[model samples]
Target chain A: MNDGLMIEVENLTKRYSGHAAVSNISFTVRRGEIVGLLGPNGAGKSTTMRILACYLPATSGTVRVAGLDVYEHSEEVRRRIGYMPENNPLHYDMRVREYLKFRARLKGLSRRRSRERVDVVMEQCDLTHVSRRIIGQLSKGYRQRVGLADALVHEPELIILDEPTIGLDPHQIRAVRQLIKSLACDHTVLISTHILPEAEMTCNRMVIMYEGSILAADSPDNLQRFMSGHSQILAEIAAPLEELNECWAQMPEVEQFDVSPAEGAYHRCALTPRDGLDLRPRIYELARQRGWLLRELTRNRHSLEDIYVQVTRPEEEEES
Target chain B: MQAYLTLTRRELSGYFLSMTGYIIIAAALFLMGLSFVVLLEKLQLEPTLMPVTELFYITPFFWLILLLSTPVITMRLFALEKFSGTFETLMTAPVSDREVVLAKFTAALVFYMIMWLPLLGCLLIVRHYTNDPSAFDLGAVGSTFLGILLLGCLFLSLGCCASAMTRSQVTAAMISLVFGATLFLVGVLSSQLPLRPSWQTQVLAALSFFEQMHDFARGVIDTRAVVLYLSATLFFLFLTLRIVESRRWK
Candidate 1:
C-alpha cells in the first residue's frame, strides 16, 4: 500500500471451474520500474496481467494498484492503470485518429484535453501519418502502435503491455522495444514476453514463471550470476593436446575437461571448474609455464535464456 | 453525462458510416412501399385516392418483419467488441457499463428512426394526392408511429442483451430472432387453448407485441400498452448492463 509501490499482488489465485490457472502468485512492481513477466505459452502470464489490470478479479487474494484494493476500488485502480492486451483488440472500422479520440473521451478526458493527449500519443507511438487510415487496412505494426496509443491516451501511472511485439518483424520489434524503453522514464511498465532476448533488451527486472508459480525473480545481471556457476569455459591453445589434457586433469579444482581439434595448429578444450572457483588465473599460469600460445580463453557468458532454463530445469538435472 | 453523450455520438455516427445501416433501411422501405401498394390496389381505390390510414395499419407488420431481418445490426453492439478485442479497451476505460449499453441502444434507436422517415414521406405524398386529405386519421397515424418507436427500442434492447451473452455476431442474431419471434406469436398461439376469456386477455396482453401495437394503431393511446412497452425496454436494458458488468469477474 505504499505510494512507492505502483502494484502489489499478494497470494493471488485464479481458478477456472475446479482447476487453478494461477495459484498463489505474489509480486510487486515499484514506481518507475520496468518488469517483465517471463513464461512460455499457457504459463498464466496473461491471467496474472489481467488480474493486475483490473480486467479480471482474482478468486482469492488482494490486488492493490496505487494503494487501492482492486476489488473494492476498481474504478480508481482503472483510472491509474493502462492495459494493452495480447491480441491488440481494436475497432477496425474506425479511423486511427477517430478511435483515439473516442478512447480518450471514454477515459473521461475533456474535449480539449483529449485532443491534446491524442496528438501527443499519436506522435509518441509514431502513428501520426496513419491517423486517417482505417484500422483494418493498416499493417500489423501500425495496428500495434495504434493500440499503444490508445493505452497511453489517458496518461495513467502504470502501463501493462502483454506481448507487445508478438507478431512484428525485426525492424518493427526494434521500434516497439525502443518505444517501451522510452516509456520507462515517465511511467512504470509491466511487460510480458516469452522471448528471452526481448526481455533482456526491454525490461529492467524479470519474474520467471512455470506451472503457475514464480520460479525466480531478479535483475538480468543477477539471474545470469545465479546460473554462471554451472557455465562452461572454453580454451583454445597452441600446445601439445596431450600436455594440455594432463595439465587440466592434474588441477583438482577442474571438475571435468575435454580437448578437441580446433581450426589449425590449435586444440580446443572445454572445462568445468568446481563451484565458486575462478579458472582464468589457473589457466593463465599453466599456459605461461608450458610456453604455450593461448589463442582463445573465454568464459561463456550466461544469457537470460540459460538462466531461464536453469531455473525451470528439473531437480535431476540440477543435481547432475 | 459527457461520457455517455460522447459514446452515443460515436455509435450514432458509426451506423451511417457502415453499409449495414444503409442496407437495412433500404430493405425496410422497399417492403413497406410494396405492402402499401398492394393494400390500396386490393381495395379498388382510385389512383389519386389517399391511403395514409391504410399505410399506418400495414406499416407496423412490415416493420415487425424488418425488425427481425436486421437483428444483426444491434447484435454486433457488444458482440463485435468482444470478437474483435475492443471490449477490453472499453472495460479498462473510466466509462461505466451503463453508459456503454445505453449508448449502443440509443444508436440503434436513432438508426431505426432514420429508416422510418421514408415511410412518413410516403404518407405525406399520399396526403398531397388526395382531394379530401383531412379525412385521414392523423391521430391513428401518430399513435402508430409512437408504437413503432417503442417496438424498435424493445428489439434493440433485446438484441443488446443477446449480444452481451456471446462474442459471435451470428449466434447473437439468431438468439434475438428466436426470442423476438416467440414473443410476437405468443398471443395467437395462446388463443387456441381452452382458457377463460379473462385469462386469455391477460395472458395474450402480456405476451403479445402485435396486440399492444394494434391498440396504438386504433387511435387509442392505452397507458397500459405504453407501460408494457416501456417495461420490456427497461427490463432488457437492465439485463444487458448486468451482463456487461460480469465480464470483469471473468
Candidate 2:
C-alpha cells in the first residue's frame, strides 16, 4: 500500500484497430497533487486519463487508482475517482441541483448525504445562483461549472478533468483554473490540456506527452532547468557586423552566434555555448576587451511552450 | 437495487422532462382516439358482430400505432446521450453496464405503456356515450392488455437495441422502424406463403403479433406467444448490454 499515492500506471498502451493511439508509457500521480498531462491534440493525454479513470482499458498495462487495480477492481477505483470528460458533456435538460443530486446518488451517497454534498459542491463551484435553472438554459461557463460540480459532488479522492476549460470564456477559464488549483489541498487532480500556460500556471507538475508517448515529466521550473542547455543568450553589440564576426571567430569561448541588424547601428547577436553554460559574464568581459560597446545582455531560458514543441516535434515528424 | 432504481428514475425523468415524451404521448392519444371514432362508425354499420373491446386489438390500428410509437419513444434513449456527449458521464457513474441497459430498457417500457394509457379513457368514453356495457368483455380486455405489454416489451427492446448501435437519433429511428416494419409485415404476409406442414403454421402463428393480439382479445392466452415475446425481449436487451460494454474496450 503506497501511502498517499492516488494513481500508478505502468507501461500503459492503448491501440485501436491495429493503430497505436497510446504507446507504452509510465507515470504516477501522488495524493493531493495537481498533475497536468500536457500535449497537443491526438497526443493520447485523454487515453491515459481515461485508462486511469477506468473509462477505457489499457491495451497491455496496469493502472491502479486509489490503490485499486483498474482492470481487476475497476468498480472500487471508479468509486474513488471523479472523471469529467472532454467537452464537458452534460444532461442539458436537468437542472443544476437536480443533476448533481442524481450524480451523487449514482455514486452511492445516501439521500441525505447526497443532498448535503450537492449543496456544498454547488457553492464551491459557484453554481448556487443557477441551482434551479435548467442546464440547457445555462450558459457555457455555467454548464462547465455544472460538469465540475458533478465531478466534485461525489467527493472522490481523485478528480480527473479532461480539457475542462475547452469552450469557456477568458473569465470562466480563470475561474475554472482557480477552482482546479483550489482543489489541490484536498484532492489529487490529473488535468489534461493542450494549452501550455494553463498547465504551467495550474499544475504542480506536468507529464509532457506527444504522439502516444511520454517525453518528460517534472515541475514547470525543473523542466526549464532540465533543458537549460538549450538556453540562448542575446547580446546587442554596437559595432560593425564584420568586426563583431571577426572578433567572435578569434575567441574560442564564443561557439556559435547569429548576427542580425539591431536598432540604429547596433548589431544584435545571439550566442549559445556548446557546453550549455552561463556565457553572459564571459561575453560581457570579452565585449569590454574587444572595445565593443554592449547595450543589452539577457539569457533566454526555455518556457513550457519551447519544451513542449522541442520534445514533441521530432516524433510528430517521424510518425508522419 | 438502489443503483438500478436511481438509473431508472433518471432515465424516466430524461424522457418525461424532454419534449420527446410529451409529443409521443399526445400523438399516440390523438391517433388512438381517431381510431376509436372510426371503430364506432364501423360498429354503427355492422351492429351485432364485434365487441367494443375488439377495437383495441382486433384492428390494424393497434399494430399501426405500435409500429409508429415504438421507434419514436426509443430513438432518443441512448442517441441523445451520445449526441450530447453524456455517454461518458453516464457510463462512468460507478454502475454496471447491465444496470445502465436495464434502466434504459425499463424506462422506455414505462413510457410506451404511458402512451397507451390514455386509450383506456377511450373505453370509458365509449361506455358513457354508448349503451353497450354488455358488449365489452372484461376478460378479453385483461388478456389484450397483457399481450400489449409483452408486444411492447419486444418492440421497445428492439428500438433500444437499435438506438444503442448508433449516436444519431435519426439513424436509430430509421433502423428501428425498419426492424419493426419488417417483423409486422412478415407476420401479416405469413398467410400468403403456401404451407402444408403443421409446424410451419405453428411457427407463423408464433411470429404473428396480429394473430396473437386477436387471440388475446378473445381471452385465449397462448404460453408459446408469451414465451417468444419474453425471450426475444431478453435477447435484445442482452445484445444491448453487450454493445454498451463493448464501447469501453473497443
Candidate 3:
C-alpha cells in the first residue's frame, strides 16, 4: 500500500437533496506535493476537502488518505491528517497555548507529548509571543496562527487547510504561505483556495474545479500552456500598415495578425504563432532585414488567472 | 478515556471561564440563602411536625432554582460550540459521539453538584446554632441531597438534548425550561387533583417529584424513583447523542 500517493479520490460525488455539490470528480496527490484545490465560490472545493479530511461523508464514491479508506479507518486517518477547517473556528475563551494543548490531547497525543508538540507548533506558527493571550482578544491573523498551531500540534503527515489565507493581509498572507511551503518538508499539504495567484505561487500543482467537476489538474505552468495552445507576440514597429500586412503574410509562423496605429507614426502589431513557436526572434530579424525600426517585440504569456477564466467560461455558457 | 477526560475538563472549565457560569452560581447561591433565611423565619413563628430538611426541600424556591438553573448550566454544553462553529472541529476529532455526550453530561452534573454544595453549608450553620445533636438528621440530609442529584441528572440531560438541537443558547434554555416546567407541573398538578381513583392517585403520587422529595427527606429510599430518574436521564442523554450524530447525515 506504499504507493507514494497521499490522497486517492475516485469518482467522488457529494449531493445535497438532489443537487450535486461535487459531481463525479477524481484526483490524486502524491507524497510531498503541495496541491491546491482552486475554484470559485460554491465550486465544491471545500466540500471535497471536507471529505478528504473525514469531516463529511461522501454521498457516493470513495476517498482514501495515506492508503486507508476515510470512512472505514476514520480515526486512523484522522490521526495522520491534520485539518484546519474553513474560517478556523476555535475556542475564544481559552489561551492560545491552553487551546492547542487541549487539541493535541484530543487528537490522541500523550500528556507529555502534547505539551512538547504544543510548544513546537507555537514556535513554528510564531504564536509563542501570544501563547498566554486569550484567543478572543487576539487579532484575526494571530487567531489564524493559533488555529494552524492547533492543526500542526499533532504532527500529522498530511495537512489539509481550507482557505488558510482567506482573510489575511498581504504580509500575513505571505507569511502563511511561507509556513505552508515549509511544511512540505515533513508533511503533504492539500490546500483549497479561490485565490488564483496564491495557488500559483505556493502549489506544486493546481486542481482547477468548476461547477462541481475538475476542469484541469496540473502544474500552474502546464495548466497555462495547455489551456491556451498558442502564444502571442506583440510588436510596435515604425512601418506602413500595408508593408506590415505583407510581412505578416510572408511569415508562416505568424498565424493571425492585428495591426493598429501607435505613437509618432508607429504601428502596433499583435501576432499569434501557428505552432506556438517563438515569433519574437523571427519578427526581430524580419524588421532588421526590411529596414523597419522595431521599437517593441514581446511575447504575451498567459497567467493562471487567464487559464482559470478560460477553463470556467465554457461551463458558464453551457449553464446559461 | 483520555479524550473523554480532556473534553470533560474543557467543558467544565468553560463554565468558570465565562461570566455566565459565575453568574449562574451566584444567582443560585443567593436564592438558596434567601430560601434558608425565609424558612428559618417561618420555623421561628410556629413549630411544625415536619422535619427541617423536608420543609427545606419542598419550598417553591428550591424547585425554582432546580428548574431554572439546570437549563442555564447545560444550555452552553452544545449550543455555544455550534454557535462558534467549533462543533465541526469537535465532532471531526477522533473521539466517539457517546464519549462527547457523556463528557458534557458529566461536566454539567459536576457543576450542578458544585452549585448545591452551599446548601449543605447553610444546613451546617443551622446545626451549629441549634447546638442539639439530633437537631439535624444526617440520613434526611443525605437522602435530600441524593434526590437533588437524581433530579438534576434527569433535568440537565433534557437541557443537553435541547442544546444539541439548536445553535442558540437562549432557544435551548427556553426549550429545556418548558420541558422541565411541564414535567414538574404534570406531576404536581396530578397529585393535587381530587376525585381520582386510588390506583390513579397512587400512580400520580409515584410520579410526583414533591412526593419523592418528601419520602427522600424522611429517609425512605424508593428504588422506583431511583430507576425513573436514572432511566430518564439515560434516555435524554441518548437523544443528545443522536442529535450530535445527525450532522453527518444532514
Candidate 4:
C-alpha cells in the first residue's frame, strides 16, 4: 500500500452472477490529483467508483483508501471519502442546512464542528441562500449543489462524483466544472462521465474504459498526442479539382493528396503532411504564387472525442 | 453513539416538520374519539365511565390498521434515500449499520408516542368524570399502554425491514401491511380451532396479538407477553440491520 496515494485499487472486479460488470482493473489516485473515469454507459465507470468509495464491495481483489483496506476498514474509508451518486439521492423533506449538518454529524464531527463545516460547505456549494428550504422544493441546479454540499460537509480528502452534470444546462455545467477544478487544489477527485467535454474541462488526468476494461490511462493532452501522427489537413480552394490535386502532389511536404468537388465552383482536398512537416504555409505560398484562391485551410487537431473512438474502436481498426 | 443520536434527531425532526406525522396522529385520534362517542351511547354510560379503558381495548385493532399507515410515514426512512440518491450520501458516512437502523427505529417510535398522546388525554378526561377515579383499573391501563408500546415498536421494525428491501415507498407499505395483517389474522383464526381447550389456548395464544393484549387489559402485566413482544421487536430490527449491511456488498 502506498501511503502517498489517497486511493489504491488493485485487480478490483465486480461480478453479478457469472458475468463481470467490472473486470479486474487497477489504478491509484494520489493526493490532490483530479482524475476522470471516462467511459460510455455500461462501461463500469460508476461500478468502479462505487467500490472505491466503499459504497459497494468488489467481488475480487482489494481496494485501499487512506492506507486502509476498504473491506476491513469500511467505516474508516467512508469517513475519509465523500461520494455523490449519479442520481443525487437525498431526503427531500429536510432543509438543506439541516441535511448537511446531519451528514456532518454522521461523519462523526462534533456538533459545533459540524455546524461550522456545514456553513463552509454551504458557501462553497453556493447553497447558503436556500439553506432553510426543503430539498424537494429546490430547483434541479440548487438540488445538485445541495448534494455536493452534503458530500463536502465532512471535509473528506477524497471525493468521488458520478455524472455530476448529467442533466444540467450549459451554465450549470460550467459552474460544476469550475467547482470541481477548484477542489483539485485540496482534494483528490475521481469523477465519472460519458460526456467528453466535461472530462476534458475538469480533469487533469483520465482513464478511458471500454467494455469493462481500461483501454488507456494518461493526461488528456498526452492521450490526444497518442493520436497525433495520423493527422489530415482540410483545404478548400476556388480552383479546378485537377489543378489543385496536381499542385498539392508537387509539394514535398504533402506526402499524399486527394481532391473532391465542393459546392458550386469550389474544390475540397485532404493533404497528408510528410514526417515532421506542416503544409499550411507551403499551401498558402503556392496559392499566392499561382493566383489560385485559397478559401480555407485548417489542420485537424485530435480531440478527446476522437481519442475515445480510437481507443474503443474494434481490434481491426485499432491495429490498422 | 453520537452518530446514532444525530441520525435519530434528524429523523425525529423530519416527522415533526412534515405533514405525514401530523396526519397519522390526527387520523388515529379522530377514530378513537368517534369510537368513544358510539360506545358511550350504546352502553348508556355516564361521561365519567371508563371510556378510556374501552378505547384502549380497541387500540390493537386500530393499530393493526393504523400501523399499516405507519409504514407510509417510515417507508421513506431508508428507501427514500435509496430512491432519491441520498442513500449514497448516508452509506458513505462513518456511521455503522446498527446505528442507522436504531436511529430510524427510535424516531418512528417517538412519533408513535406522540400519536398516542391524544388518547392519553382522553383517559385524563375519564379520570375527571369519575367520583373514585383511583378505583379504576390503573394496572390494566398501564399494561395496555405497555402492550401498545411494544406493538408499535414491533411494527416500526417490521416497516423498516420492509422499507429496506426496496426503494419504492408504495411497495414497502404494501408488503408491511400484508405481513402485519397475516400475523393479526393468524391469531384470530387459531382461536376457532375445535381442539382440546388447553391445546387451543396454547396455539391461539401463540398466534394471537389480542391474547397477548388480554393480560395487559386485565392489568396483570404478564412477563411472558412482554418477552414475546420484545423478542418480536428485536427480531425485525435485527433483520432490518442485516438487510442494510448486505447492500454494501451488492
Compare candidates 1 and 4 on DockQ and give the better one: 1
Pairs in clash, predicted candidate 4: A89-B84, A89-B85, A89-B86, A90-B86, B140-B219
TM-score of chain B of 3: 0.95
Model 2 — interface RMS deviation? 1.5
lDDT, candidates in the order shown: 0.83, 0.87, 0.89, 0.81
* Candidate 2 local lDDT, B146-248, one digit each (tens): 8889999999999999999999999999999999999998788775667767997768856887777777877789998899999999999999988888866
Docking band of candidate 2: medium
Best by TM-score: 3
Q: What TM-score does model 2 achieve against the real structure?
A: 0.90
As for candidate 3, its clashing pairs are none
| CAPRI-style docking class of model 3 based on DockQ | medium
Give the range where candidate 2 chain A is weakest over 10 consecutive residues by summed lDDT: A246-255
Candidate 3 lDDT, A90-205, residue by residue in tens: 99999998999999999889999998998898999999999899999999999989888887888888999999998899999999999999999889999999999999999999
Candidate 1 TM-score to native: 0.91
Model 4 per-residue lDDT tens digits across residues A1-320: 56689888889889978889999888888899999999889999988988887888889998998889988999988888888988888888888888888888888999899989988988988888999998989989998898888778888899989889989989999999889899988899999999988888888899999888989999999887677666788888888877887777677777788889989888888978876355788778878988888899998877889899877777887578
- What's the true lDDT of residue A145 in model 3? 92
Q: For residues B1-250, what per-residue lDDT tens digits would candidate 3 score against the true structure?
A: 9999999999999999999888999999999989888888987898776767877876778898999999999999999999998987887778888999999999999999999999889888877876755547888888888989999999999999999999999999999999999989877876687846689877777678777767887777899999999999999999999888776663
Cα lDDT of model 1 by residue, B84-197, tens digit? 887887777777789889998998888877888777776666556554566356886788788878878878788889989999999999999988777767754654445566
Better TM-score candidate (1, 2): 1
So what's the TM-score on candidate 3?
0.95
Instruction: Specify the highest-lDDT model's number.
Output: 3
